[model samples]
Target chain A: MEHLLTEDLLCNQLQHSTKQLYRTGMVAQISLAISKPVSQQFACTLRVGEVGVLLAPSGAGKTSLFNAIAGINQASGFLKIGEHDTEQIELATYKRNIAYVTQTPVLFGHLSVGALLDVVSAQQARPFDIKWALEPLKLDTILHMRTLSLSGGQRQRLALLLAMIKGATLLLLDEVLTGQDPSTKLACITVIKTYLKRNQAAALIACHQLEDALALADIAFLQQQRAGIKQWQVMPISNGIHAYQQSLLNDCADTAQDQQTVCASAFLSVLHATTISHDPQLGLCEYRVAGQPCFSAYSPHISAKQSVLLVLRANRVAISKSLLPESSFVNQWQAKIVSIRPVSCQGEHGMLIDVTLVNQGALTTSQQDVVSVWITRLSYNQLHPKIGESWYLISKADAVSLSCLN
Target chain B: MSETDLQAIILTLQLASLTTVCLLLVCVPCAYFLARSRSVVKPFIETIVTLPLVLPPTVMGYYFLVLFSPNDGLGLWLRNVLGIELVFSFSGIWLVSMIYSLPFTFRPLQSAFEQLPKDLHHAAALLGFSPMKQFHLVILPAIKPALFAATTLSFAHTIGEFGAILMIGGNIPGETQVLSLALFDHVESFNSQAAEQLALLMLIFSFVVVFACQWWQTQSSQNGYVVNNHVEGL
Candidate 1:
């Protein structure tokens, strides 16, 4: 449980003019602790054998932070990687043993895939295991092909495998999972998990996919920018989910997109559930969250007893005053309102109510689940709901989008 | 052909080959630096390298003549300390050709390096390859077309050297005398047959250099095979 990277950086915000390079008088002060041994008061710690998702909008300095850690950009302040004080010692990028896979895969265009594999394998003290690493990425077939001929997804996969082969103890993956197919993305997440556990390494993955972040992040950091200043806030996965959803709302609103899409993602609530049964014939899957049974439409690829991450749009969930209803809604769970906040999306006023599921004796305090329900201003006024009051959270089975993580 | 004509052809080939090889050795690294450097003086250095391209060959030759004169300090030091003569010798003219053809060998290389993807060197470094290995395995392979063009152009320019060679090293057979000088001599003395032979040979050589560079570039683009700019081998 040792810290892998610690950074306190102060960098100039530079802008290019037609005639000169000038500082914009806005300096970025960033402090980060990657895989810290213990959670410090200020910085969020991603310990050993953990993947921390970095959630931020565009132009929020996510790539800049990655560049600083990889020594591609200059940043001056306290910095450490493992036992070395990188700032004091001045280690080169290669010597830091950190692999960075950019958004666009930066493969060696001149070398064939096989040659690149050979060269990467030779550079390691422990030779790269081709079968173990390449099989998951589906790169075994393209060994003889030139890297330039590879599709974007294939290039990303190759870049991931090559970084793994290099035995880097820390990985900086910037938007690498964007636009990937579900199966490939699942495989990539799985490979990263196994690699981290096996080597006791760590990764800081920057991604915009909230679902992927929910499935992959052991801890998450949210970056918020205001008036050209950026700040980082660390939280557990659940809070990170809420923060990310809110950020999505702001982003969509900023772009003046349709309010429905913005509001739909803004109030999304993530539930960590385990499948109890999957009826492939009926295309229905039953999962248990907070010791209560919930059903969702099932995919044939998902089996029983596997862990799944479920996303439910807040507006899709409803609040009921009575016990389990006999309505068409297939899900109704006992819960207590924890908090309520008023939200307005493009002049459509609503109330966002947060509720914690009343778990049976089978679960612990941390395992207690929180779900958000959206209701119109009329419904909020009619119900006059109070905090810690009992209610039923109801939703139809088809409203849940489920992705199996394991 | 006369024995002196044969010697002139041999001397021209030797000088071209030596100048091309040595310039490549020196200029590749220089080009890489210029392409990657952000220093304020980079433009100044680049301007200096490109100066020879715009200046007449005779002008460069005149400067070298003054610099390498026997009475000059550097020339005197070379003779008294290193025992190397710069004026009226094969070595003197070879040096002059290297300087004269500097841009031919360097400009293409610099352009190639600049056009390369910016992440290539950084990616190689993160993969634990040393700088030399990165240059050899990544930079060299990626810029094969420019390397080819630079080599052919430098060789051809040296083969056609007339003014610089004449100024620095006079027509001395088996020493400084090359094909162009020998052909110039033949024309001056009205040796029509020998002059015609030399002119035809030079024309054919020039055509081949141009044709080879064009063919290599076309093959590289058509085949999508990058290393050595050909698809024939790995």
Candidate 2:
């Protein structure tokens, strides 16, 4: 029988709210209030040598949760490492056992990379293979160089190497590969995975990019909602990419239609749709869409069939006092002046007019079609289009194209 | 050099060394306490430790004279119990030097202890090193420069002491006559050559000691053993 990969996994994981208190680490019980009222709570447990990845949108409290576990911040739960268990221990002692890698690479500016590893290993009384670690991270050439001279990605890799040298049983990495290019990120991930496997070391990493998380994670814990951190479900590696995508669709489908409309309107609403004819000069699959026609200008991830919203730069639009005759342009609409406001652009005064176009019988039908166009106050005065006056909107064919649905 | 001059220099060195050793033995725990203790009385005790640095030396000398005089109750008790008389003797000079240099020894060591990363202590504890072992292995090694600075500063400061040593023990030859006092005696007797030579020697000794300490600090920092700079994002 084929495995059932339902969209409900996404919905349940995203919508389900549960409170879990983690008392693991060196400190005592840290209660994460995971519920609708105060939901920014996340909880996950990993045995020694286990590796887990936390996938969450940016600003979803992943760093906050990591900090609490590392004993850098006060958490309302119990944490135990080794023997002495309490909310408070000598901070240095706590740090000596746990190594933290921040989103931005932080290295001692005064020390060489080699010296950093030496100091940490000496303090921990552990013999570390500095050359081996640096070689894997592609930092062997720069081991003798000053830490201050390294680039952002290089510094991040160096920080990881240092943390490993400390031999901390638990490593908490926050967006550790965020600053690296795709190739470098892939290389770093491979090194980390191999290292964890060989050493049997436990690691918890927080990442915004899904591909990186997917490539390295043994078990994925996704942050569903903003308020409560609930573990909707866990998937093993056997489920694959198809299962993940299906779970996401099911999760979206399980939400009430009204809720879906709210999310869709705010994020995925198809503001405009247009077709592009095949032109060798313009290339294949080139098209113009609605809204502001600046989607392709802003994002690089645009593709066919994916919904997009174009942010209309008001200045790029033209408004005429009379209805525009049908022409070769991509967009033309008859609209009434809803509101007019003055806006400044590059030391020049301009008027931003919000025009509402009527379609069918209802106002909501074409409300999304209503677009704002910016014209100089001088030009607006010359035309003198009153608030109640009617006019047509026009945009050049090349001014708009397909946009990525963000 | 005259017999008196040679004897005073020897006595001064002996007293300063002994006082520094004694001061370290007592000040290690005191400095550590001042650095680490969170108790409310710490400030009060620290003030008392530093009082000698600010107190008028003559006034301190007068107080010690009264306390250690043969007829005084404490003096009589010490004499009966330990067969020791502290007034007008080499021992009295040693006692006064230790008290006078307390701040010199404790302040630097205390500040150094305070500046050490608290995380190092925590790491030591997690490593199963008991508190005592942690001090010996981690805390002491980290504060080596401060300890050296404290000992040198205290020894130099005690050797140069004049007012308190003179007022309490007087300038007795081969007993209470420290170098500073003997130099004063030479000047009084119109022996400018002897007085100048002694002053020059004292200046050279202090300069060499201080310069050596500075060089050692530079070498240690270059060795990358001392973590003076903060580790970012930790």
Candidate 3:
């Protein structure tokens, strides 16, 4: 009885989610220092409930970063998880709720998956229902098979399930989803997003799917600029790439949205939010924009609390005189007409107009918010959406894509 | 074969068994350390362990004689304190045989351990298996073939030892005259038939030992696990 009570108390103290902590507000910030000389020193912080993506070329120390935190590599630096500093805890007794899933499967070939799963589940302080845990990733069929017999995708999923089974509060993925197919990717991300939402946890995903993966990250660390500051730079993806990715995101609403610090060079679509979640069945993922409820494309497979970028393509957006109830466009937003600049596209005979559309989410900033929507000059002349006048910005669901940055 | 030769063969078996057992307990730890240790002095210790493999048996016998001779400090200490006489005795030959067979047992075990992947150790260590448990669960099972080879080679080497035992035990019949020494005596005398018979016996014993080891090695290389009283490819 005493032993069980002690274990419970330890779990509670180490747990990050509590009613008091939620009320008071807590940050699941992971501040780690990579063991290197001052010349190559790398240390970064990821806030609680935020998913940061580490982007780098092969052998740019991405896995090294994960290895340092997992205590697998030789490292000497401060590693703090939640409220517990690893330096203060006895290594023999300290059981961290952080799980690092590597790209290659680390398995005992002789042991069956079910046997290993039982061991991992028993090790956890509070185990989730095994059936519920295994169903999302389709791990039920593999329970009796030897791990060696599983294929690469099956092994990766099983490894991920094993990690999640331990009730890890912080997940470290080292390119675990680089080469997976679309459905497997969706299933994996769905499981991850749901778990993060349920537990209020954070994750650091190191990925090779650089552009495609950017849609899911709250803050992406590309590379540390060698300038005097030696800081990470937020480089931009191409306009076509961004628009297409956003369209894909809106179709899928594949991630959550949260307030995170990002720098400028290319990635400019960022919104400040406390937390966000997506619904896959309803085909809608929702999050707050400037403390007001906002809705975007409905993604039937998206998990709640996913990062999403609301993207409006300049070509597909139209300026309207009034809210058109009969318009086939699914997304309609009310914004003040800031300016209408005459522009030409591809030397076309028709005149094109760049209409500056602003929303309530853009109102919070003292700096003038700039949101642009394209309209044909003939349509603009007929409707004549005046400057400083309220007008509806209407676009089709296909025109709006959930950008990854926001 | 003569009654004396038969006694000599039995004596050789007993000596080989005793030497192989002692060498295993001593060499296993020595070989394990040599395989795993990263110390700067590891090479020098390894050289010492393998010295018996390269050094002449007579030269080793000369050193052993000087160390355990009755007048020597070690010999005096043994006789006075423990009253264990070693000179020209079965114990004397057994001790000499262990030194002669050290490399035969040590090298295989060292190589077997070195060939194991570092990830195996890393995985087992983080899983909270103690060093003793690691030996029993992981290390021992993986190196069973090497252990068997080492034991068989050590036993055979001790049985065939002639030069070192001659120097240490001085060929006292029924005391230190083993198979090889007894065969050597017949060769030195004019008894060609007896020498031929004893040589043929040693050759047949060696052939059978080598053949059995090879067959087991081949089988182990094939499917690994084998059941006794069973046919293959069933």
Per-residue alpha-carbon lDDT of candidate 2 for residues A1-406, written as tens digits (9 for 90 to 100): 1222223342243223221212232212223332333244443434444556765445556776666566555544333333232332234333445667777654545467776566556655664454665666788888688776788889889878776666665677888888888777766776676566555456778775545554565555554442234332334322322233333434445653322211111111113443333444543333343322222222334445554333344555678766455755545656678767554322445666767654433223322444557677788789887787778766654444332212
Candidate 3: count the clashes. Answer: 22
lDDT of each: 0.75, 0.62, 0.62
- The runs of at least 3 residues in candidate 2 whose Cα sits more than 4 Å from the true structure, single-residue gaps closed, are A1-42, A47-50, A53-131, A138-159, A166-169, A178-187, A206-406, B37-39, B117-144, B210-234
lDDT per residue as tens, model 2, B1-234:
888899988999999999999999999988887788999999899898889978999999999999998886898888889999999988888899999999888887777778776665544443334577668866787677677777888888888999999988998999999999999999999999999999998999889777866776676566433432111100
Cα miss at A241, model 3 (Å)?
Answer: 13
lDDT per residue for candidate 3 within A1-406, as digits (tens), equals: 0111222343344344433443442334333344442222334344556677766545567777666555556444344455333341223211555677777756545457897677556555676544665776777877888766788888888777776765656678877776667667667776777766676567878875644455556656554435332223332233223332233323223234312221111222333332366666766556554443555676454455554445544566666767778867655666677555554222322223333335355346432223455555677667766678877667665554555444
Between candidates 1 and 3, the lDDT winner? 1
Model 1, A256-297: lDDT tens digits are 554334454246687878888888787788998878888988
Q: What is residue B183's positional error in candidate 3, in angstroms?
A: 4.4
Highest DockQ against the true fold, candidate: 1
lDDT, candidate 2, at A360: 31
The true-versus-predicted C-alpha distance at residue A61 of model 3, in Å, is 3.0
**lDDT digits (tens) for residues B1-234 of candidate 1:** 999999999999999999999999999999988989899999899889889878888888888888888897788889889999989999999999999888888888888788787888888877777778888877788888888888998999899999999999988989999999999999999999999999999999999988898798887654343323321210
Ranking by lDDT: 1, 2, 3
Clashing pairs in model 1, backbone N/Cα/C closer than 3 A:
A35-A46
Q: What DockQ do the predictions score, one after another?
A: 0.47, 0.15, 0.11
